[model samples]
Target: MPRLPIIHKTQLVASSRLFQVEEVHLEFSNGEQRIFERLVSRGYGAVLIVPMLDNETVLLIREYSAGTERYELGLPKGKVEPGEDLFEAANREIMEEVGHGAHHIQLLKRVSLAPGYMGHHTNLLLARDLYPATQPGDEPEPLEVVPWKLNRLDELIAGNECTEGRSLLALYMVRDLFMRLNR
Candidate 1:
């Protein structure tokens, strides 16, 4: 079997609100070459959290995703506004999507989504000690908010119930943090 080609160079093809698609040219170790073989771009996003309320419950949101064409359960998340810092974006999204603001916010992690093919990255945030704040004047789209305990968190993660990418990452990271604290 022939070895796959490696990308030797990339050039910007086009850019949009969230990302820039690039065309990559590649050369195989065995001397084969290809042009414009890959499309890549970065998307900006924020991940918000509803931390354990009283050591047991977590706030979650359920809604239908047009992109996935499925009803999904996850925490509040959305694209970062232009020129917005990731942490600020997370806080803004949480309030907009979940109707609660984070009193304490910690950036848990920053990761790339499918770096091999895409340029999208997400910031995972752990927010705790939430309280009711002023709601957005424009009505938020329909969402179902529910609280679940730590025991049930695994069930949500295992069952593919939390389909939102950033939400799942944040949840898993928080779960790991909790496990470490208990030890």
Candidate 2:
């Protein structure tokens, strides 16, 4: 294996209410040096939940994304609050975003979104045995709950609305897990 680069220095370059950008200087083993900017992570990361409405249906939410400036269909997710476990965060997010709480929740995987630049990590969870519930969320507007057929994920990905990579990845992971369990 190649040796990891040595981070010689790090400096904060920018800051906002939600994000902090930092510049890191690294020296490679081959006498190469480079400086890179990354969005530093805060808090206990996040959780993205794939809520199964039934064996074939999955619940998604259509929420307006500030980054994209439009409503995007994606799985329910939120940052893990201080002192909250990953399962607690997943259940809370599903209730807030999809109006349901899961009786069964399992951690599927931990994933990163653009590891080359961002330090954020998200835990993908599979939630099943849902019951009707709701909790106040920080969303500016009510999220539109969208029920999608798991078998037709290809169609969902083909559309322009479901563009969030993390959500899409979670959906696929859940589908694969369901298939394995049934087999």
Candidate 3:
């Protein structure tokens, strides 16, 4: 493995919020030269969770995304604000999107949404012990609250119900958590 830093960055192209981009040439003291690679960069996102009372149901949200121009069934998520910690962002997004607060937040995974063509990183959080709170702020109207049964988790996966890769990964982690809890 090599520690590569961005020598220079430039946006080669931008279309529909996805940038076909590039960075300047890279060089090492050992005299190795290579062009810096740039992928579609969305930076970062969060996965929010709410465990139902019996600890059997997980709260999910269905909301419309302008970028995709379609409704996506996913766990609550949002971009991280400047200089914000990932967990803080996750907590804030959960409250804002679902009006819920989580007591136990375990980071299940960190995923690269498109290692081939995107510089996006989605943080997966396993949140438990939830309580109601006033909604954080305005988002798309008519946010649908879906109670996802732990046993039926695969239904969503099998149905290909979720479009966000981050949400899918989060649910997969929750499934793993469920297996651990059942033991």
Candidate 4:
């Protein structure tokens, strides 16, 4: 692997309730220098849960997204709170968003959103053996839980409401995983 660029300086460029932007000054080994801005991640990180309703169905949620200003259909996801392990956070988010808790949970992978400009990594988890459960979430309104068949992922991705890249990638990963396991 190549050596990483040296960060000469960093400054907080902006801040908000849920996000912080930082400007980084870097010097490369080849005598190149540049400044870049990134959204500084806060807290332990986050968990995106691909909750399986069955071997064929995955649970998704339709909730309002302030960033897109529309209702997005995606997997249940939330930050991993202080002291909460990834599995605990995954289960909690599923309970809060999809009204179910998983008896079997496995960490699939860790993914970054815009790794070039965002210092955030989300744990992608696969949750199975679901049971009915609900916990009040911090959402302003109730989330609509949608169970989607894994076999029809292409149709779901074709829809406009399911545009989040992270969610789409997680679904594909889960589908591939199940296929390999069944084989």
lDDT of each: 0.71, 0.93, 0.70, 0.93
C-alpha displacement of 56 in model 3, angstroms?
A: 1.1
lDDT of 4 by residue, 89-115 (tens): 999999999999999999989999889
lDDT of 2 at 58: 97
lDDT of 2 by residue, 1-183 (tens): 779999999999999998999999999998899999999999999999999999889999998888889888898998999989999999999999999999999999999999999999999999999999999998888889999999999998898989989999999888898898889
How does candidate 2 fare on TM-score? 0.97
Q: Tell me the TM-score of each prediction against the true structure.
A: 0.76, 0.97, 0.76, 0.96
lDDT (Cα, 0-100) at 27 in candidate 1: 89
For residues 64-168, could you state the per-residue lDDT of candidate 1 as single tens digits? Answer: 777788878887767777888876777787677677776778888777777777656666777778876535624346677778776576688678767666776
Q: How accurate locally is residue 30 in candidate 1, as Cα lDDT from 0 to 100?
A: 84
List where candidate 3 sits over 4 angstroms from the true fold.
Answer: 1-20, 23-37, 40-53
**Displacement of the residue 125 alpha carbon in candidate 1, Å:** 0.5
lDDT: worst 10-residue window of model 2: 173-182
Note the residue pairs that clash in candidate 4: none
